[model samples]
Target chain A: MAKYAGYQSSINKAVFIYSPEQLDYKFSDTHPFNQKRLELTIDLLTSINALNPSNIVKPRNTTEEELLLGHDIRYINAVKMAGHGKLTEKQGEPFGIGTEDTPIFPNMHEASAKIVGATLTACDYVMQGLSEHALNLGGGLHHGFKGRASGFCIYNDSTVAIKYMQKKYNARVLYIDTDAHHGDGVQWSFYDEPNVCTVSIHETGRYLFPGTGTITERGSGKGYGTSFNFPIDAFTEDESFLEVYTTALREITDHFKPDVILSQNGADAHYLDPLTHLYGTMNIYKEIPKLAHELAHKYCDGKWVAVGGGGYDIWRVVPRAWSFIWMEMTDQALPTGNLPKAWLDKWQKESPVTLIPTWTDPENLYDPIPRKTEITEKNQQILEKALLPIRSKNSELI
Target chain B: MLIEEIMKTKIFTLKSDNTIKDALRIMRANKIRHLPIVNDENNLVGLLTERDLKNALPSPLVKKTVENIYEQNLEKLMITNPIVCHPLDFVEETALIFYENRIGCLPVVSGGKLVGIVTTNDLLYTYIEITGATRPSSQIEIRVNDQAGTLHDVTKVFTKHHASILSVLVYPDSQHEEKRILSIRVKVMNPLPIIDDLRKEGFDVLWPNMPGINRL
Candidate 1:
């Protein structure tokens, strides 16, 4: 917990963008992409006395025009029709609705639009100088595409928010996705735009979903060298994961010199998560936000908007991991020792698996990854290749 | 996919009597390495490559007068009757030809004339597309016995999940002689359900294979 020291004094102001309606962005009870994680995380922050009602802001419903910023009108219409039970399976197939990952539910368009608007609200708060930072635990649907949906995402909130910031505030955005899967939607949306830079560090596509995040996927046209990806090997531990993340973020921030920072905090890299195969523990969660907090203040005047993405282990992983983001955003001292008894008692009854009773993961979370040395070396090579252009530029300057 | 689907119809070509300087100018302007030579009837006669032009040029260290080097006709340097392909040929077969012959480009001939050209670059792009890396999807690899109907048995799980299969490639397992690996790219982000179904069907899935840990 001492690692979070010195981040408090630099904070100017922070706000939390949330609303009960955001929970409407649910696919089903059995779906892994559950919104219950949001409620649980908010409760954990509340129980710890880190988040106050006054610091919370209600999110607005995104207008069709705003949704059109990153989505096709036809696709939006199809989503609306599917929500109202008017579109058939065949009709919704092309739009990525009526699928197992992103099935149609009641008012799907409105629910998805609200999530998009929540991220936009976070961005507006930070961009308009109302707050130095904002957190939207309901957003970060990074896999939603311009014409269709993939993964469990319907409307891409991060992409829409970036486009909004570019048009309204005319600010250059640097998007950092620390998810297990590749941030393909947001990366492709800004692939050709010079002002918006996207960096995603995830499990390699060799076995991961949405397989496109390789070291060679830099960028195209004017945006060449703007996009960066660091796909580490599966079963990568905390040290190797954080090494690539921290080094790449520092170099990319300095090279791009963005006006603001947008981070997609997907907590599925934990060992408890059932979706992906990254062997990360709770240590990476603490370090992930610490770097973002320090770099945002140093580079973008503390203008940062944080959003949630994919995390399947709702009870044990998502709540603790997401609360750390809000705590880091508001410059609060990190929590240590045991979890709050009241919070644990309430969630333990509902959680099928026994809840972890500490702020940090226990030792020996998983068997020692057998190929730790080889995985670490391969990740280092990837990091070097990704940062080659910027390193060369720095050498030339010297 | 057919060869015509990936071949480039907008070609940079030269005539039989064209000077070496003309070939050099076309290559440089277009940033191309190969050029097809044609006759008066617009029929394929020969092929000129940058390698051929490099061999024909005089050495830079030579002080002797060599103005005639650039004026030499390309017919003297071009390879007559180079390997050519037809438009209807399968792209996979064309790839085999490229691999076996160790060539970079193939001129597509139809009706006794050159219609298009397929370079190594185009074939590589086709491979990328076939793997579905250009789209957003997850890849799953399954190890199964090299017996009959293994593919049919494995694909049933994907059909149960209604997950669209973007690409399916069957390759021999190097370590095991009797086992084969089915590399499938499906158009979905969450592949857990399908992976579970595969495991339940007694198929060994080698997803994210940890080097020393043998989970299978």
Candidate 2:
């Protein structure tokens, strides 16, 4: 039966984290990353009537000590002083505050801390069972390490929320990332821990930036084999991605029995993204969240948190792709064809000159050959080799 | 700008044969105000606005049986031949029709097929929402060359000016296949000073609110 999942009684559960303070944390003028992304996303959703006012959740400013929950105290102090326009002796460079990638914008600590707070709030809603799903579209800074920053990310919000979950609820968490770039900081922060299962699939570090998430770097000490990485070839298409992702995710969820699932829904994996070589389409991107929604219902009782990360082709791709994701999370009726003309015109007027794609699903995009059958065979070997049976075999935190 | 550029493509419509009661129910279910009435072949026949349904009440003679009265005059009341446009119609023409007609919506028809629809409210709302016209600030436009470092430098000026960028447009320039001319619109007070700052920094800035620059 071709199922048309008619509009379900949607529970409003989206969090939009905006602060005038975040206007400070910009890298460069020409870079694709900016506060404009959030503004455009919010506008696009609102213009399409996707952002229901009742469902819109705004952000709160996180305190200094609250930031110290997952980050070092010294790092927190460095961020605070940097926000006051006072660069340390090395230009506040050591703390990754005043760098070209992570420029020390005014109110740096407050802005970055709120990102942590936003993700933590989403986690709280799910853990508290306030909603079936939670989203922090503004809070997927997975590139930030515990001590320093890298890859345009300041503090790792995912790690902060994971620690909050572990400490506050004593919950076992599973973190999954399909960003074209590896979630290095998130992996390393939980590398030696057994309770957290970190799985990242990206272009092998051999070719991309921040070269980590190697096949061999499966956790250490008591957390051996808990971390999984599949650094596939550049331009790895969607079919292979779905195959590997679904298999690995299912095996880990079945084995670890996590209480919650956190996923980084990065759009950089699209073929058009200039930053990465992956050729994932919105079709493939939409499926991941839909499947995750189901898995959350089956396994975690619908406790899922999704965060937006990377996508450079802003006009042509990012807005539509992320809107698809948000629609899936909210279980709203999906709009067909390119964005509404009213929206496209407004988007073009605001951002004229860029080619505004007219179709929701780009009709002329390249389709990846179906390789699920072949990929599933390889994925099983990877899963067995990477996911150690330590969780079920020994209940103690060995 | 073609009608395809400004019309709403995603819309819900009803057939002429569908009962007013059923149509009303569908409209209520979808939270929609207008329903395009189509024939069996899906040709636009008429429209049924919420007001139309509401006005079709029972008279004092039939007040004793409201349900029966509603059943009697269901299909007899729908407004036929509502204003519409073809997908190829110019957006300016549609805007004029909307202004002169003072109607909220116009369905898009091509070869008598319902392609899409546009509402005056949608256009007005889009304008206000995107331009940030409601924010009480002048709009400044900067003509940027299609280059890696150009946009970075230009936006940096806005960042320094302490003016929030309301919206930006990367006008698709056919001249430079390698680079695209990006025209950014930022909302701020006194754009001349920032434009001068940009000029000093060797950037091509267009201050629309200035004497020579037209608002278009």
Candidate 3:
């Protein structure tokens, strides 16, 4: 159990889940799924005096039993063996290990379990009422499957943490993924369970990897009408991104009425992110968490657990975008003007690309997208299609 | 792949003497569209489809209800001597039959006995599997000259990166007659290294391409 520094009667007592070991979830020095963003994000928050030790909590290691809630025992054994160099490449192939995306690293199982434990810790804090909200920058490996690793994710921390909440606290979880890629692993985990609803708003999978989050992928069996997806066009700007995000999130929360909200905050949708093509600015990052914070209080009794995900532009986009999530969680006023001079001075020399100087992005971040109107109109159609079930049900009631 | 491997062996069937009402009840209960009409010796005699049943029934807007329509024998409406496929036939050959006949399903016959059935849905799913969209993977397209050993040259890059190839499809380039587009889906998320190697080797890689964008 994490040591809490007594209780203050503050309305927004948010816990930031962190540990130096969380940085151990590294694939390679040059790999795009870098954890150095976590360090940079924490340093930025520290420099602004927005986060301190009392508000920071160290993550625990996830146990084998808890891991079994989401992963198969055979896959877990394979991961363990691969971490120790006992498993051969052929042996690891079926389990999606030793591949280019998730290469075998020393003690990988421990590292991945620690990230899962971090997300579970955040869930415990929020669900147990130790905090109104919690943020685990190490978690949100949303592409990890039950028996396979994918998209640079080894073990899906979000899915395990949601299952932990379901078993330990009996809480109905509403998972919201804002990653540039589809949150397929977490969505499929509870595809037939009515108690867990997943909503992912991402770039369309027409040309992207892991291409499946269509509007037609509503949940199955008893969980029908519980899954929602909004695949926006490639060049979607911040205004259009947030329009679908806010509308779908608000209506879904109203319909599901979940006991807690677990959000995966992947900051890679920015224009600077190399992997995806969405034109999201820092504005969407600021608004993404604000709505979750408000709705957690409204529908979930202020219970919210957040985790970090795919943000490849670690130097330029990730740190600032993630820091905004923490600031929102703590109910701090959104920062404005130039970034902390000390933080920028420390990171600029190390960053290859020039960092954005202001808390807000510069005007006209890229050449104006040629088909902005058509993209927005298409996204609006997708939003309607995704919400059709709930809309029809509400009309039937009326 | 053979039709026996992909066909659904456990199928619903009806005898020719069974009433149309029996076929309708079985179709509704099983939620199946096609039924093979078999004789006493379990030989496929005819095929009954949901479309035939619907055409035999009275329309929803009709004021006069026809009482004798449900009591009619299925043999009167069934497609006698319908085109049937052999279980030993290649799946590709079976698919061609579907397209050429403009039919939705084909019952698999083995030794003059009804054994299995395959529908257009099954064939479409087989296409999806062959395209490798069911797995977690990334797709890469390369334009190569329509010559031998182009596939060998291109796949060498994936082998270098230790990436497994899930599926490879070859199609003629619409713009260039001598060029062919090789769409390869590999079971890995980050294809940057492979893409880099292909570019370094002077291969034209159209990775996640969009319209109105230059291939640079």
For model 1, how does the per-residue alpha-carbon lDDT over A153-199 read when each residue is reduced to its tens digit? 99999999999999999999999999999999999999989999999
Provide the overall lDDT of each model, using Cα atoms, as 2-decimal numbers: 0.91, 0.70, 0.90
Tens-digit lDDT track for model 2 on B1-216? 677877777878877667767877888898877888777787888878888787776555664755764444345777777888888888777788989987778888989988888877677766645543332233444566666788788888877855555466576545446546454444332254466788899865543222322322
lDDT (C-alpha) at residue B196 in model 3: 92
Query: Model 3's DockQ?
Result: 0.48
Worst 10 residues of 2 chain A by lDDT: A1-10
Which of the two, 1 or 2, has more TM-score? 1
Report how closely model 1 matches the true complex, as a DockQ value: 0.70
Off by over 4 Å in 3: A1-7, A10-12, A88-90, B214-216
| Predicted structure 1: lDDT | 0.91
In terms of TM-score, how similar is model 3 to the real structure? 0.93
TM-score for each prediction?
0.93, 0.59, 0.93
* Model 3: residue A31 alpha-carbon error in angstroms: 0.9
Better of 1 and 2 by lDDT: 1
Q: Which tens-of-lDDT digit does each residue in A61-157 have in candidate 3?
A: 8899999999999999999999999998788888888887888999999999999999988988888787889999888899999998889888899
Question: Local error of candidate 3 at B111, Å?
Answer: 2.8
What are the chain A TM-scores for all the models, listed individually?
A: 0.97, 0.87, 0.98
Top-lDDT candidate index: 1
Query: What TM value does chain A in model 1 reach?
Result: 0.97
